[model samples]
Target: MLAQLLCKTGLNSLNLNTKLFVSLMLLLAMATQSTAVVAQTDRLTLIYVSEMTEMDSEEKGSYPKLASLLEHYRQINNHLVFISGGGGLAPSAMSSLDMGAHIIDLLNAIEPVAMVAGKREFSFGEDVLSLRTYEAAFPVISSNIFDPITQENLDGVNDSLLMTVDGVTIGLLALLPPIAHQEYNLQRVEIQSPVDALKQRANELRSAGADRVILTYSCCYRDYLNYFDELDQLLHDGLIDLALGKDEHLLLADHQLDQMHPAHIWITQGDEVAVVELTLEKDAPTFLMNWQTDSMNAYPADAQVQMLVDGYIQRLESLLNEVIADVKTEFATFQTDVRTAENPFGNLLADVIKAHADAEIALVNGGYIRGERQYQIGEQLARRDIMRELPFRDQVVLVEVSGEQLLLALENGFSQIEEIKGRFPHVSGMQVEYDRRKPVGKRVVSVRVAEQPLLPQQTYRLATRQFIATGGDGFDMFGDLEPLRYAGQSNRLIADILIDAIQQSQQIAPLNEGRLIDLSSP
Candidate 1:
C-alpha cells in the first residue's frame, strides 16, 4: 500500500535522482517487513521418556498411562515429538523371556520420532539387539556406538536422526557410555568417545540446517559428573541445544532440581515424564527452552493402549504364574538392603549360584537382585517372582582366582559402598568384614572362605554372574581370566538355576548368616 501511495503521489516533474531514491526507500521497507514475518517464533513440544523398560512394573508409569499422556499432547499440540531415551528394552520380567520384543511392540503403538540405544539395549547381546531393533517401528539411534567389524551403525540402528516438526528442523543424536561395550556385554559394538562424537555430529547437524540439536546419553551415575561438565560446555558454545540423560536414577534421587545443569535434564523413574518446550527463532540458530515434568497419573490410560498392555500381561501370566516355592520367612530384595548390607534374598542367590557351579565360593552383586520388595512369610514364590528378581538372564559361571585377586575383587565391591553401587558383593561360603571408615582399597578387615582364613597365595574357585566373571561393575580384577566353567557350558540362566533350587527345597527360609559384616556400623 505504501509503494502504491508513493507512486500515485509522485509528480511527473520530479528529477530522475529523486525518483530513484524514493524507489530504493520503498524496497528497503518491503524487505524489512518480510524479515519480520520470517522471524516469527516456532513452537515445538518434546515429550521425553527414558528407561521405558521400567514401565513393565506395576507402577504408575505403565505403557497405557504413557500412551494416554502422549495422545493428550498430540491432540492439544500441533507440533509434538515423542522421544524414547532407550534403556527400556531389557531388564524386565517380560524382557527376560522375549528379549525385549514385547517392549518394542508396546512402543510401536506410541511411535516415537526416535529411540536412543541405551546401554541396556545390549542386555542380551548384539544379535538380540539387532532383532529388537529390526522389530522397532521407530529409528533406534546411537551416534557413539558402531559395529567394529562392519564399520557402520549396528544392524537396524541409525547413527543419528533428522526430524522436522512444524517447520522446525531437529537433529537427534544419542551416546552410549564408552564403557558400555564392557558393562553391557556388547560383543559386536565398539564405543567411541562421546564428546568427540557429539562435537562432530552437532556441527554436521548445524551445517545441514538444523534449528535445534538434542543429545540423549545413557550413562551410569558415576559418569554423570564428567558428562555434565562436557554437556555444559557444549551448551555454552551452542553446539547442542539440550541434553537428556538416562541411567542416572540414583543421581536423580539424590540431587535436587536446582542442582541440575540448565541445559541438561535427567529422566526420572518411569512414573514421570519430562516435557520440553522449545521456541525456535526463524532463520536463526537459537531457541528458548522450558522444561516441566509430569506424573503419568495426570492422564487416564488410553483404552486402546490399555487393551494392548492387558493382552501382553495375560500372555505373560500364563507362563509365569506357576508356583515355584512356598516362603517360610520374609525375603528381602529392597535396593537399600541388597546394595548396602547383607540381604536374605541375596544370600540365597549367591548360595544357589555357588551350588550350581559347585564352586567353593560365590559372589553376587547386590544389583543383581531387583525384586525391590519384600516377600512376606507364607507368600508363594512364582516363576514370575524369580524372573523379576533376576531379569538379566545372566549365566552363572565358575572361575578360579588367587586369594589375592579375590581380596582385590572384594575391595572393589566395598570401594563403592558410599555410592551404594551394585558392585557391593553378596557372598556364599565366605565371611567378609569391612570398615567403611578406612580408605576404599584398604577397607577389608578380613575375609574367610569355608571357615578358613583367606590365603593370599592359594587359588579359590569362585562362582559369579558371567557379567562379573567378565569384569563388569568395576570388578576389573576378574578380567581376562578364562572361566573354569564357561557360561555357555550351562544352558540354564541364573534365574533358571534359582528356580530349580527353590523347587527342590519346596519351602525357603530367609537366611542372613552375617556373611557381610560392616565393622563401621554402630
Candidate 2:
C-alpha cells in the first residue's frame, strides 16, 4: 500500500525528508514482532535471520516479510534488537552488483546491530568481504574464521559483537564448520573446530560482563547434531541466552528447541523468521528467552523498505530484464527430480554449457540448479531469470578424460543415490545407464559419449562446472583429467554464459530423452 501511494505521488517528487520518513516506517514495519508473544515492559525483542543468502522480502514473499515486519516492530517497540544469521551474500543476490556492499547498505537501512558469517559468505574472497564489512554498519563476526596465510584474524571479521540495549548487554558469536574448499576449488580463509571455538569465546563474552550471549552458526544443517549435548550444557550453565542454526529449509521452532534449551531457534533463507523475546529479570532463573517464527505474509510491505528495494531493483532492471528468449514449455527441476533422475531443466543447462565450450560432452551438479521454484511456459527468459535459477557463479571447465575416468566419474555421481547428493550428473552429450542396486563403484552399467560406446584408451573432451572439474561433490576422477579449454580462466560464470547462449539461440526447448537412466530395484 505504501508502495502504491508512493507510485501515485510521483516517487521522484518525494523530498529527502519524506523519503527518510518512509524508509523509517518501512524499517518499523519490517521489525514488527509477532503478536503471539507476551508483551511486557522489561522484555527485549531480537529478530534473527539466518542463511538469508541474499533473499529479501521484496525478492519473494518468503517468511517474516522483513520490510513490513520491521515497520510493524518499529511501531510497537523501541528496543528491538535485530541481528543477521549470516549467509547474506549469494551469487543470485550479487549477480548484478557488489553483493556485500549492496547487502550492507540494505541491512543498514533496518539498523541491525550484528550478524554471524555463514559459510557461503566465503564464496567471494576475504578481501572482498573485508571491504564490505568495512562499509557495513553492523559487525560481521565469526569466532573460528581466520586468514590461512598470515594466520591472523580476517580483516573485517570479529570473534564477537556486543550490543547494549535498555541497560542489558548482549554478546553474539559465529562458528563455522570446516568447509569443502578442496572440492569447491576456491580458498581465502580457514576455519577452526566449531566446538572449541564456541566454548572459549563464549566464556570470554560472559567474563566481560555480557548479560546475555547469542550463538550463531552458518552451517545450516542437522550436520551439527553432534554438538547438541554441548549446546545443552551451555544453556544449562546459563552461558548463552539463544542459539541459532539453519538446517536446509527446516524451521526448528521453539518446540524442537525445548530439548536444547528454553531458548533455541532455527531459521532458513525464506519461509520463516525467528523472533526471540528475552525477558530480563533480577534473578538468572527468572530470565526468559521465548522464540516464535512468523511467516512473511503476516505483515504488509512497508512503503519505506519497498522503495529501498525498488531502488536496488530499478538500478539493475534495465540490463538484467532484457529478454533472451521465450520458453515454449515449462522445463522445470525439483529436488527429487534433479537429485535422482534427469530433468528437462538440467538437460537444458548441461546443453548450454556444452554448447558454450564446444565440448563433446558436458554435465553439471544438481546442487547448482537452485531455482527451487518452477518457471512457466511462454515466459520470457531474461538475465534475471537465469541469475535466480543458476546462481552459484561456478565457471565452465573443459577437461580431457579417458573412458575409464569417465566411467568412474559417472559411478561417483550415482554413488550417493540414497543420500540424494548433487553430484548426480546431468549430461549433455552422453547417455548413462546406472543401477542403484549395484555397489557404489560399480553402479555404471553402460556409458556412451559423443555417439560412441566407451573405449578404454580414448580420451574425451568434457565440459563441466569447475565444482565438478575440481572434484566437488566427490567426483574426484576429474582431478586426474587435464584441462582442455579455458585452462586458466575459472571466473566465466555459467549464468552469464547461459544468458548469452539463450540470446543467440533466441529460443530453447532442450530434449528430455534417455541421457541419464536409472535401473534399480525399488
The candidate that achieves the highest lDDT relative to the unseen native structure: 1
Model 2's lDDT to the true fold? 0.68
Looking at model 2, report the run of 10 residues with the lowest lDDT sum. 2-11
Deviating ranges (above 4 Å) for candidate 2: 1-41, 53-65, 91-97, 179-186, 223-229, 237-239, 251-258, 268-271, 402-408, 415-420, 437-442, 451-458, 475-482, 485-492
Residue-level lDDT tens digits of model 1 in 276-373:
87775556545646888877777777788888878888998876999988999876787788888898888988988888888899998998777777
TM-score of candidate 1 relative to the true fold = 0.86
TM-scores of all candidate predictions against the true structure: 0.86, 0.81
Query: In lDDT terms, how accurate is model 1?
Result: 0.76
Instruction: Give all candidate RMSDs, comma-separated.
Output: 12.4, 8.4
Q: How many collisions per candidate?
A: 1, 24
Question: How far off is model 1, as Cα RMSD?
Answer: 12.4
